[model samples]
Target: MDKNNLTPVEKNKSPLILSIVVGIVLILFLAGGLAYAFSTNLITMPFNKAIELLVPEISATANPDSSSIVTITNPNSTGTIYYTIDGSDPLTNSLKYETPITINSTTTLKATVIDEKDNKSDISTQQFTIMEKTVEKAVETVVPENSSSIIIPEEYQGTWHSIKATGTYNFSGNTYTYSSGGNVHSGTIGKIEPYGNSSTILVFYPIEVNHGFTVDPGEKGDGMIKIDGTTYAVENSDVFD
Candidate 1:
């Protein structure tokens, strides 16, 4: 056969073709290794982790009974928040901030946060004041009923002109007689003048036995006033301090 008319059989054994085939195999092996590394998603993290080490945000609330609730919000999405209250930072194992407080008085509410990467956040505090309790007062008192010997606490027997007793009077107790809201009160002192049961139109003897009365501030009728609400027996005479 002429050299110029190369045959297909000669070309099939060419060294150049073999070399190209070897190169392709090596390239494929390298490419596969690169793909495996990407699939595992390993090398891309630490760099990402570095950015996440930043701090987080925290919020807090307090209740009336001296308790508080701490809420930690993690904006990084890639990290979580760990926090503490007890007036301490996240570096300690102190109580985790949760639940509301029953702050009877003024109190301080605090919160802190930390990410999974040990990133520390600033501490936050809130001051709160609790509502105070109200006291009930007794301004006036009712008189006693069915009493013969009427002795009054000298402190109570005062000349009182109250438009309070207008209707039929109803009173209880044997120690004292007084009136409230248009009701006559009879006590150990028998009956109090002016507000006492209708007696012979005459002057009252021993004006000393009459218990006194005081109108409460900002009240129309006699207010619930008494010496701590305990019944005081007619002192047979003048009741001193």
Candidate 2:
């Protein structure tokens, strides 16, 4: 058809339709750009603040002669801090962080904060390097020939159960009786020496050894080490129930 033959409505219709298509295309381009920006963190929504909590901060104070003290802090003070010293991820059921942790050895500590709203923060990790302290070996004092036995400490003069070994030890004064595997062995405490800051080494001298027993008779310098006032290490195994 000839250009001049076309009606005015037809002439206006093409231009109006072209303008509508151009406007729609521009709007779709803008929407696509905005979606990409939001997804890529180029732009963050205001509501995202309510979804994620802030991360916690972990720090440590070093002690050259002893252990390192670790502290965990969060910006939001209303939350409870949970931490792990075994290099594991922190969970709600993990060790609750109340007081500062005393790390005796080198450890990797991880911590997280859980707010009142149950919002958990990202894990914060820190590696603590502890200075190794040389532990002095306990010195043995020669016992007099006339001395049959030494008085056992009052704290250690009781019946104690073994945690790892299948035995029960009863201590009364300087005498000790160990019963295991249907066999009984009696011994006397020869000497007591300080092994460490919180440990004592008790040297034993067996008075009667059961020939049927296959275990140690607590003689020949084999002794028990009291650790932390509650546990005893006998023959390199923890003997505390």
lDDT leader = 2
Clashes of each: 36, 0
Query: lDDT for each of the candidates?
Result: 0.44, 0.68
On TM-score, the candidate that comes out on top is 2
Candidate 2 regions with alpha-carbon error over 4 angstroms: 1-49, 135-241
lDDT of 1 by residue, 1-241 (tens): 7766888778666777899999999999988987787678744545554442445555556655544454555555554444443344555454453443343455555554555566555555555556666755533343344435434433334333223322221222224344557565553434333323322121222223544432122222222222222323222313321
- Alpha-carbon RMSD of each model: 13.4, 15.7
lDDT of 1 at 7: 82
> If scored against the real structure, what TM-score would every candidate get?
0.33, 0.36
